[model samples]
Target: MPSGLPSALYGWPGLCCIPLKRKNTDRCPASLASLIINHHEDSKAPQLALVASILGLAASLDWKAASNLNPFEKCMEDPDYEQLLKVVTLGLNRTLQPQKVIIVGAGIAGLTAAKVLSDAGHKVTILEADNRVGGRIFTFRDGKTGWIGELGAMRMPSSHRILHKLCRSLGLNLTQFMQYDENTWTEVNEVKLRNYVVEKMPEKLGYDLSHRERGHSPEDIYQMALNKAVKDLRTLGCKKAMKKFNRHTLLEYLLGEGNLTRPAVQLLGDVMSKEGFFYLSFAEALRAHSCLSDRLRYSRIVGGWDLLPRALLSSLSGPVLLNAPVVAITQGIHDVRVHISTSLQSRSLKVLTGDLVLVTASGPALQRITFSPPLTRRRQEALRALHYVAASKVFLSFRRPFWLEEHIEGGHSNTDRPARLIFYPAPDEGALLLASYTWSDAAAPFAGLSTDQALRVALKDVAALHGPVVFRLWDGTGVVKRWAEDPHSQGGFVVQPPSLGHGDEDYDWSFPYGRIYFAGEHTAHPHGWVETAVKSALRAAVKINKHWSRVPSPEKQAILHRLEHIHVSEDVQQQEESPEGHVFVEAIPQVQEHITVETITPGKGHVHVHHQNIPSHVHEKVFPDVHGHVHEKVFPEVHGHVHEKVFPEVHGHVHEKVFPEGHGHRHMHEKVFPEGHGHGHVHETVIPEGHGPLHPGGHRQMEPGSQRHRHMHSSCKGGGGT
Candidate 1:
């Protein structure tokens, strides 16, 4: 049987078949069917082989898909392989190199830059000279009361867009700091002033000036004046306003130009000096008012403002080396290296090579760092020209809220003059925190005092305000972090000197060699403010991103894409237009006119005529137009009586009437009242019957009792006769 098989079955030597048989006679044809089935199965082998080969190919492709990685990791594992692969695949990695970005100072600006660069696929390293990340935002826990004391930058305004956004993203909690009511207080001059309810004082003064403004009770007029003044100031740029106001001190501006009285000047000066540093000039004060005009609505931050830096730091993927002080910077055309000292014992100096270096240190710290190729003359001059104001901030936490009880009356207490004391009544954990600041010359006296001495002086000042009550002084627990002594931050913040020159005027203060970029609150727009820090950082980041041509990460790219697509809707556009062109004017209504003329001749040979037009349903209310009356009274009384009459013509209509009943009569009434119910009667009766006619015409000549009757009737008819 095997020999009889077809030649096509020669390759299938192992082929086998089984036949089904119904009885032995029916199974006779089964053998033949089995042979035919074997031939058909043999013919289908090639097709099955093709199908198996296709499935094997698909499995190999799926394995490759599962093992694929991002370009970053691929490059890290095999740099040479990645370069070769890019050359063959996309032809892009020939000149591709990792970017390094060094950020000096681990404050908010530094952290922000680090996060931005890191997210942009750049290698970032942060060098913070201080032991901690927060530079100016120092939070200390009181040993006794266990309350937190913010010795550095504390309150953040609600308008701080970046800070507020960061806080919300971080899920931090912010608590409001409650201020005590102002009651009894003494001024810096030692004058005792009783506190009056601020809400009631304006009503009492009959002027309505808000707390922000000082003036009369009807606040509308004062507000209008302020709005106009603000509009005018805005029309003139801030720099121009500063320059315009710079020549005069606040005192001089208030008294000479602002037209403020001595008392008003003193009150405003005291408030401004206490709130800001005393070093702030009148021009600086105006600039501050302009800058903070938008931020005057809210003051707070959840979990303290320090959370801002912390949140920024958390977003940074790079290493932040705290206590690592950058002593020098060496720059090349393509690479900048920074020398940082980590510790005294190790003396380990790490060289950080970066394509860009951001120096976020204070103005004073920048002055101290040595540059390899010395900073340009222009940059050096800028550093020298910029001056940091010396400010000392002291925070005191008490066991109980004593100041709140004492100053809780109506207005802010005036006890601590020069030093404004804001009592936090129901503080976190029922603790009281007092923050005091002095600037320029006034700050010198406090510099020599220790933490304990400063606390004693501040407590004593508070005691004096509240009448010598016992202070729960934190002796060992008192913490003082003076910015003056801080190495990284040599002073509080930058203050433009009166001699610092004008707006956008190029200052020699460019970063050393232009390779190192300086940014912080001081470098921010409009000078020192928390918002400036974030804004300055963003500006610097934009410059760096532009230089690198780096594609931001997926998350950041999505954000940028979404922002670019955003546009203002038409509804908002329409609302922004001025309404002046849309305003309509209505025509005045017309009424019938009645005119009356009368002549008077007095017995003393004095003749005068008076005229008035009285309208129905309306009566003339007499008020001495004092301004016009003054000018009329300037002339001497002619013939013992200055005869002056007001004849105001309305729309070219003249109604003239004689006084003293149209006869030569002397009227002795001080005033006259029109005939009406509940009206004020004139002091004297109209020209008496016996008196001569006001005019030359006698009553009898006009008519009999009819002449006098007609005269009386006409007089009464003219004035809605009683």
Candidate 2:
């Protein structure tokens, strides 16, 4: 009846089954029913419908002729499906050759490099400065209230597939991070307003400012201006756009070429800068927006964002030494020696030598280490060319939800006050509040402030926001996070400036030195994102594997092919398609139960599945199991021969032997029509008035290993309703 199955099918974790929408329709193996039923544990009605629909499609394409042929086995015999199984099995069950590899820093980049190399049969060692693993993915929780504060990287966009893969491999679940919405609050120069009003207020504010704004909504103006600017520079693509915008700041762009009235600029500046708009490289900002502005539904780990890095660390076969910060690095033609020592015994150093090394630390942490023979001029310049900004977050736990009195939902409130913005936790998730989060230069003034002083400042601003009447309702119990103030990380993460040639003397400057490599966000193309960090790490591993690797398997070859071109193009992340991953193999169940089919009757177009439409010609076939139990299957008569088999009792799921190739062919080439425009990305939400603080960790905090950028990561899908 419906064109396809419900959206709930895709939401089911670990399944890559495609939806059969109106446009771009295609048929898959008819045996997907038996395959999914066998691999998938639960036999819900939707799954059965999915199976029946697939079979219906096959039947539409002449199912009777091939019904006995077993499309599942043929689909399994497909070469691509075989290749996928090879890699997935390798990814899950490979043993390395135990070559000594040293990874400096326990950040995502370093850990990723370690995981890839170790999985390929190498001995890996990770050295981290802090006692804990996740360098910037730190989660601050109030011991008493169980409130979670993502002080560093918080939300991830759907386009960030690499990070998503790591999360899935680590067995993590993602929940949407609804930061902005129509029910948000915004404070401009002490005038408090709701987001819903701001989104609809283009007409009331001005005759001078009202030159046919897009939707006459405040968000419309901002979005239109942004879209226009992005469209203008997008021709140059993301890379060149990065160079063009890198020369100017957001303030310059909005006034000079962005073309906004002074009043409009001021209005947007108050809100945008709080989201880390000022002084940030315009190209980086625009790049972040251009690539990810579409798919707007942002999400983070269910339990805690910190759990992802922890899972990564646990996936490693080697030792992850904590508090063992790498103090110095020495490189030779054949080997690398990394000098590491704990903070308690800084002077007592232990040297661990490896055939190859990957340095995932730099900026503040890099400056702390001594490099023998010195880093190349270009590398040193690249390091110096990188900019780091102070970012501070004050987490406030209140006795009660005061904003509810104002009919304000739990989101972020934008303000021009010193506090910048305040974010409330999700609904019924308790009353822990991210009282104040300031970025870049805005964070400077509050960086050294005491927790009480920061709380007072946040309260004053909150009072200024919701009203001074509510100051007494808040009980001050919270902690402040000033990442720049930390000794390990000088200032949040690195932001790229214009004309930065991130070259090194190592491996054509990209893979770094023959014995040593650089893998961090700053070292990668898209700055300030863990995605960039992970990409850099994998890139380094690819180079290392190329230099010294064991005998290659087909699975390893596929993985190599994947890692070789992980990032799209140097210019933009768009206009190019990513290589598809294990399309159907992993999504299907590996273990299939023994199958038994009974009497067959091909239902007519008007017949329900249980109703027998085609006359059944009963003929029975018996098979004996290991338990000596006989299974008799009855089928319809076709030209005096048994016509076809019917799928009958096999408990709640499918059995393997009935359709041997069930596990391999899981995906069908079908376009999905979500409630929005389609992309390989996620949904978009209304951000005009939503109030989630930046949990940015740019290609992470613009620096890979530590820190997040000032904005939340999002993907594009063409949804304008938000």
Candidate 3:
């Protein structure tokens, strides 16, 4: 019967016929059917190919019947595979032109982008605000006992193939992260019951549930609520159905389309630890639900999740600069310039010019950095308004495996208390328990408290769940991590609140602008997952590779090359001190560029001026005395417009001034330059034509209208060089 089909499609002769659903008989065959054929032990059989051929033949016959039996169609229904395919392509592709790419923030997204781009021959440099690598992938390990706890992200769903594949490629070991166990406890409405028995009786738990929802578990009933929405998603497609039903919040969905009693919905929220998240968009909730359903198991790295980032760091061919926070980014006609504040004693501001710039900072961190020319109004509004949920975790180490004695190897206890969830890792996890895992409203209070105060609050909640004996078992060591309190990560993860609506366009702020690009989990669909971060990284890298040929011109490259050679010496002698021990040093740039000035007002004052674009044979040095005064002669051969600026009396303030040049004149200055003070004075000059070659008589060479050149001043005590 199947002789015309490819002979390579070998499978079991057994076949089950399925009746097609017919809506019309005009072009229908009397014997319309679908076949489910069993395959043999041969794994390479062309099963799907044969099925597609049969479907094609049926379509050629003008059959009016509909069939959803195509395995390819079922799998491709969602964009998950398409996204993963892009990630895999990025991971496998290694041929590309080498370009200078500067990635802001050394988080997972930044690291992944750097890894892929660097492997493809790009010279990538990662600038991290904090001293650590992993942004939200932090891990806390006890130094003495070797116990470990995840302060940020903990679990990895088995369905996250990209993350799993990355872990394997990085040679990291993985273990089952027992997300739930039958012996786990659920406490709600002052009543506690094991998870296995919670579904048996709802009335005893004070929940007035419906007849159909009575015997179903909270997870089951949640699926039941999504049944109609899922049907709409299947029939009307994701975009149309989401547009139709996503206007409702999770709370609204449960009350309206879910058709469940209020008590039942409330019970579901309590048992599922989603009380704080009910206000989020139902569409966002559904996306999260698809990733976290019971059908997909979870896993975690063996030692700690930080190993992944560390491995990525080790794999990079470029450097990762720690404690270097990027303060500003400017997009030029040819390249992008990133300004970073160094952690050195000089507190010097460094400018890194690259072919492409990828910003992987979190939403809050991105808000802090200044952008030249300004971002689009929509992107700025999205950055200002998009919501990031608060999350806090309290980890406690126990001297003994107390929960194991109760035959509970791993799982979590859901409760209506301040600690919405308590997770117990497996025995091999060194008895370190996530005593408190709270999100959104539940985490707000914890984020404001000190570690000791947070520990006390968490202990109180744990005692309520496990009785007073838990205090005795606690090993006197606890770690509290409030993601909102973290300077790098202002909040835990991003979520589209109901107020923001359910459209994915709200998060499109990460889209590329000019030569600058954006990445991070917040910028992608299914926010707050490591997989999302990886996918976003892949996307940014692919875009960069596609648009990488827009390299800077030869003149721009020369200026950028010269900028890298400009170095500031850290040697400065201390002079007379002020009564309050205030020291201030200001910087003036040679070219019309953006300069970020940082001041360190300690006790004394000294000034050292760095002369850039000078011949290798000649150098100019300027030194200021205790009176904060310097005498210098301006270059006589200067042919450019001279714009003099005076600085006000800066006692203890740090100021940044941007002198953007339109043609050859400074039409506008971002900040106010105070009138010249006789005590400490700084002047500004913009060289229109290129500076001529430098000689021993204090002349230097520089590009015309170059934004990459800057002249820095530091306090030095001596005299001037010839």
Candidate 4:
């Protein structure tokens, strides 16, 4: 028997034949004698492991213990994530034309795009406006004390697979980023309490909460409110859901849909450190909530987050033009011309012509650049009116790790003071503490104040959260970062407006204008995350790679051939029902007989439906009937671009509609830019990334709402589609 084999298999009850490696002939004891079979292949390790697990379950009669082995875990599998990962691990086919590519920004998005295109044998050049790289991934290290402060993107969720893949590829070590801890303190309205006693907060703080909202935490209240507002969003599909949900602000959603009392809503905002973002769009809040949900775990890169970008910079074969801001872009019939301003005093310019130009600059940065024919009215409007939330951080350097005395480790402490959220650095991360972190309206006050003034205000908040003891242990040094004050990035992360577009605000920010392509967190849905920046980079790289010839060498063809499979599987999308009563949905795979069964009464219907794992289609149903009879509907075989009506004999007429490519739904999508290493307040913005979360409204192109300064949003997880 192999050493790695389970010990339980050796002491099983019944004696049976076991599947062994090609050279081994072993008789294994198992209870499932009839199911035993002999296999003579070296690749049977996985099969044998499965059999062992099943036998162990059967013997122990512990179904719950083996729940992890269940196939339902496949429901969590994202085809888009898998396909994108494959692209990162197995790159695109070499280009036949080998065109020249110009990447506008040297941020994570631009760098990733440059690396991919360069690896695919394209001539690539990166023009960075700032002197340094790593746009929002700013890590400030004290020269003397060696303490580090994350001014921009500090932590990310473990579910952000694409980012994890990039970090792993770069050989960066990821350490646990303690986002929440039960021992953490919460101070609001001059009332202090531990997180474990959170359920009793309303009573302790004397808030007149409603009966339903009395016992719940702010997170719970938010979740309940979110569920109520977008309860039918999934079944209703994207277009309908967007229109339905995007009409209100978070405050409105909480009051109307959530049905929470005014006091309860205020308590939630205060406790969650989101009072500044109360007026933000409920749709955008949901987008941020999708990524920052409690279901995910957060971590930070060892050393600093900037290491990932530095590693990416080292891996790139292309040249990066530092301090080179693109002043103008002119599109011609053949290619695109980018004018780079080399010197401020000399008034000199350098022009670079590229077959494709990927502009990874922030929206505000884009407004400064002149375009030849002028961008589309919608694109220009999106650039001009896109909302980037103001975010600020104040860091305090202590002589010792005094918070540990209070048993406060890596978690954050929330307060309703000027410092909305305070992050305590890990024990191994030196004695630097993120004293004050504010977003949206909360950050507005800090943005106008000088570094010294902001530090003083933050210290007062810290003293209020902790005690007067903070003054004794403080090293008399502080640092502040205000995203609004940064010239490179005008704001922190983006927060979509209540109405996506009706006036100046348009939702089509990601679409390419002529040969000028956009690749940034802003271009990605749930924007303002490092992961999204990487995803956008990958997207731009793929689009540019698609410009090459279909015919290539055998090896290159293999890569492209694999991509064709991905496109076939991942291209299937969800759209709204037709104007008429037509509900277009994908056929569920693994369901050989009927995909859905329903019981419909006179008006109400119960539907038991199974969703397909295919990327092209989603599992949806008309309705189940009232009676016990299970109506079996034979779905028509769906092929590429074919419109087949799925007729299921139900109580009412079945309305199934599927939009062919480019027909029904569409959307459009920031970064936090970090500043200098000095204490003068190095403000940085982080744009969330990855595919939109699972919602009734479908893929959200709108950027994420207010996010914690040090911790990332859950929306940063991997998924495919632009």
Candidate 5:
């Protein structure tokens, strides 16, 4: 297998089997099967590989799948590995009936979902509010000078494994993003200092260390304390250990047990203040440090960040609608209906229906759009509680590298001044400068200002830091991007408050809410970076895959249960016990053998299993299990009364499982009942996004253009950049 396959084949072996995209992404067997195995390899292997690839297609992503699904029930009873191997000899795959997916937003998360699902042979269509791709990977290039400067996300770090994979797929080149080339200067309050990349950095704005703080660099000290505090949180048994840090704010935690000197605290406070320190939790902040402490290689896309997004768009199999904003999302038992605006200025709406719907828009944007059945209180609350960070990037391109006149190539000049952090681009004579990259309060003063005013203010501060000599020769034009003011995003990325718990990452935010699932960086553990956004989208796509081709498996049900309980937040937990959350269901009374317990992605849903005769005209699709048994065909919508007929069985114990919404029941009766003595019951099986009541609302009320299911493909556009 090693000799015949490409050298890069081993990068994602174990991960390739799962629905989720892990660090390493390898070519799927479906695409490479013919190329890999031939008569020389094995004549029948290709057929087996095709079947195995079917399983690969269906089994796509969840962070928790690896934990519960142990080799799909560990020991197999029938057509064992060797025998099953005769078919798809080289692979163990499950079949999938591809579905229609409607993805909102053409950001990294949205595009990634579209790419993955489409690759798995699913019909995908993307709707983007901005008439362009790449949500935050915004770049501005000078037509005359051909100089590129970032207006949104900047450099890519080597540690961003997922981003690198995409880059690898696109065959994009990466060069050093001289963000810290010269270690520039600092201009705080009145004190001005240079970023002297010497043995000791003593600049007084952000990364400078005084005599007392000499031993610990900001990165080193923050990482050391975080590691010590979160040492237990990373492990499974740290349940009680997490509580101690959960209640405190980052400031309080930093000051705990005299962790730093007075000056050191002030220094740390100045830097962290750029982000929200008062609201951020100690645990969440600590997790952030873990990524920073690891060796970082700050590099940028060779041409510009925008190129990467464009490249991603090119790789996608389907068309993406530009300027198409989904005004309403109506989720039905069968499929989801999304009514999107054909154009930003047009009042006309188009209805797009998909078996699965994935919303990768910012939370604020999501909130503005109506959920036909208003999102459950749980989902609405999460959306409301999740706050977005307000930030702005101020960019200026020059005819020549003025910093080079002083032997400065690239690097940042930290400051508590309104100008904030100034980053230098390449050493090229004509390059761009990130004059001000500020967040929170530091960004407020500049974010709302006009481009000229922002450039004027930023340069004044820069002049103060490095003297006016650096700007004697300048290009008057500048680009100022304040994500907070963007009409589409509505706000910057999501941030955690002190009230956010450590285990909040495990919360099932990515779980499909009915037929719709949410993605974007905010949905994943690492809330800020591009890598997290792509990874998060993959998880949502995988979850949708599981929902589409559900099979009867104890491990899958258990895994879905875990996904269902991901909402361990105290508020949500309390809501589960509340009145609206109450749920009750009773199905078949007994199970003689493996009564096919078909699964949909776990949610507050009820299941009714009948061991009696089911009508053959119902048209059920059967899926072969690891063992010889085949599970019953499943449908997307389970409305009113469902005739769930399975094999006959008698008296058995009730299968108990807890869910957030009104205790929705899933009856997993053991094989204790005798054959031909099946008991029947009347019950309702409905699943919502959260543990809450499902309300039937009005029809989608599609407008004139509703017949056009696809988002109209048009020239990409965005809010004009200065």
Candidate 6:
């Protein structure tokens, strides 16, 4: 038996080796020496002899070469022996200390966090309850249509910097987005509407229109009304707006205003209340409007919105273990150990331990996670306070452009019923694409339908707008997605109910968790849109960056000042009045010591006043000095025809004596000789023989300095000219 061996090692082991004293070599089994030599040469030898000899047992055994033996060299000399020793050492080390990390979900956020941690020199394992990535962003392809449709999160506007940056970093080619212009069509009361500018209508109806135009569609009109109402409320101040309109619904408020006709109100109510399903008070609607109005307009991604999440996933530098579900998170003082189960195996669990853990799942998923210490009441209350609105999208591709066929004389009438239509010509194809949005109750019918069933209903609606809708060619490339069903995303976006009351408290509630952060359309300020997404992500990133380093708030006041100044300048420019009124010009030449009376049309034919011996260069700078005193020099007699003019005499320039045909009632024409000069032209006061005066709104041809005695005349019809 090996010296110092435990009793357990010697008593019950199946394979045992005993060391016999050299003096009692006769008792040693003959196979012992042969076994050692054969095993060593066979490269399948047990390490007992090697280890024992290295520990000074060879000296007791009187082995001559034991001192010179190199255990590592001997092991390396044989491939099988080297691998066997390596396996044993690794097994021993693993038994002493193990490593593990737990990732919460398989969605984009969870996958992203896992990939980041794994890349940063940590052993990570992802626990995904779902079978696939891209939580709410789903792509569906119909075999019949041969086109792919994005059922969820379809659009990513150009302003999505993180997404765009990731795409660039991943070397992915992004497609340019098509503008939703005239090719778009909308349906109203089952009648096809076209050529409408929905965003501009509210302004024409005496309501203030702020925010970018959303074009002509029910969505645009709804958004416009909501936006205008919000601006009106904000102008009145938040406190006052809330106090005045908090109890009223949008329908009640609009009806009270009496700004909309009954039919229009009914149509809007059907679309916004019934179809949109947004049951919001006037205050809530205004808050939502204000939030969304601050964001950039909606836009679709190049290929689809899926490109963004995929790009983020492809850029991950670590391995992502798919189908691995996390069972538990066990944390110690210094490290956290995660228990995970793989789909391939059930009995044994894989453990990953790490220093820090990040949970990126949704609110509901966060609720499901069992924290060892448990979350505090504040965190729990926050999770409960945050509510998500159910959002669903239905996309259908038609065989051809059908709405274009049913058009009146000049395309479509703006005042008529069909004016509410929204249509946009498809990029790279002649097809027409129409998209519509509905809220709460309106979303119910389409929410439960499968992709095919949704397409059928949509096509039927489309057919009703365009006569028979004969072609019936649905590419079947339709997408139906219910965001409410997603475990990671319990709903599409954050929407406040009347009960919650419109305020920032709910938003402020979600931001207090330690190290753990929330981002996405729901957490976005002012709600769902590409701008909000980018802004929210940026704000989160900034918060993280600020936590890592001390950064001072920039001099934003300067920018604000500049913006204010620009607004002031714009207001001033917009207020510039058109020169519609008339006035007379009375030129008083100091040197000549005489006044020349000339009638000036405010916005019509020019009036000429002559001053002799004036330098041309000086007059060029001083002439047309109607900048200030023109308003005071009004001549009431020719006030309807004469506008206003002030001709400042040049210091050394001379004016021609002959009066032009259009020189209205030119009198007191004078000539002045230079102080030291001799003969100078005399003032004739001759109206070029036949020319009388400048017409109020007519054209006349005359040469002030020419001696041509004939006058070419024209009469004034109105007090203006072309």
Clashes of each: 29, 39, 7, 38, 26, 42
Each candidate: what lDDT? 0.44, 0.52, 0.61, 0.60, 0.53, 0.38
| C-alpha TM-scores of all predictions | 0.55, 0.61, 0.69, 0.66, 0.63, 0.48
Q: Which candidate number would show the highest lDDT if scored against the true structure?
A: 3
| Per-residue alpha-carbon lDDT of candidate 1 for residues 1-722, written as tens digits (9 for 90 to 100) | 13443221111100111111121211111223234344457887665455334323422333123223111111112113333222222222211223557788877777766666556555566777776777787766655555665667665544344555545555667654332222544345554443323212322322233454442211112122233323435577545654655554554555555554454444443432423432455555544543332112234565466766776676665556666577666543334657554344432333455656888888777766655334544455667866676667666665566654554422234333434543343423444355355655446657878888886776666665656443544332345556777777877777654544445353522222334676787764445566566556655665565544443445433433332221111121122212221111111111121223221111111122233222111111111121342122111112122232222322332221212222312121211122224332212111112111121221110001111111121111110000
Q: Kindly list the per-residue Cα lDDT of model 5 for residues 201-258, writing each as its tens digit.
A: 4333444454545643343344334434534444533444445555677777666743
Which numbered prediction scores highest in TM-score against the true structure?
A: 3
Superposing all C-alpha atoms, what RMSD in Å does each candidate have to the true structure? 41.5, 26.3, 15.7, 24.9, 19.6, 39.3
In candidate 4, stretches whose alpha carbon ends up further than 4 angstroms from where it belongs are: 1-79, 293-295, 500-510, 549-722
Model 1: lDDT to the true structure = 0.44
Ranking by lDDT: 3, 4, 5, 2, 1, 6
Error of 5 at 608 (Å): 47
Which window of ten consecutive residues has the lowest lDDT sum in model 4? 665-674
Worst 10 residues of 3 by lDDT: 7-16
Across 1-722, the per-residue lDDT of candidate 6 in tens digits comes to: 45643221212111112231222121122223334445667776566466435333422432113212212112112223333232212211111111223445545445444433333333444445555556666666556544555566545443344445544554656653332333234344434433233322423332232333222233344433443444544477545655555566666665554243444555454433322323555555554543232121234555555665565555443334444445444333234444444333222223344433445455565665544223444455556765677776555566765544542211111111211222333334334243323445555666666767765665555455555653356555545566776655667766554444444233442242322344444554445443344333334333333332232224322322322221000111122222331111111111111112222121111112322221111121111222332232212122112222222232422232322212333222222111113222221111111111111221211112322232212110111100
Give the Å error, residue 273, model 6: 8.2
Lowest summed lDDT across 10 adjacent residues in model 5 is found at 656-665
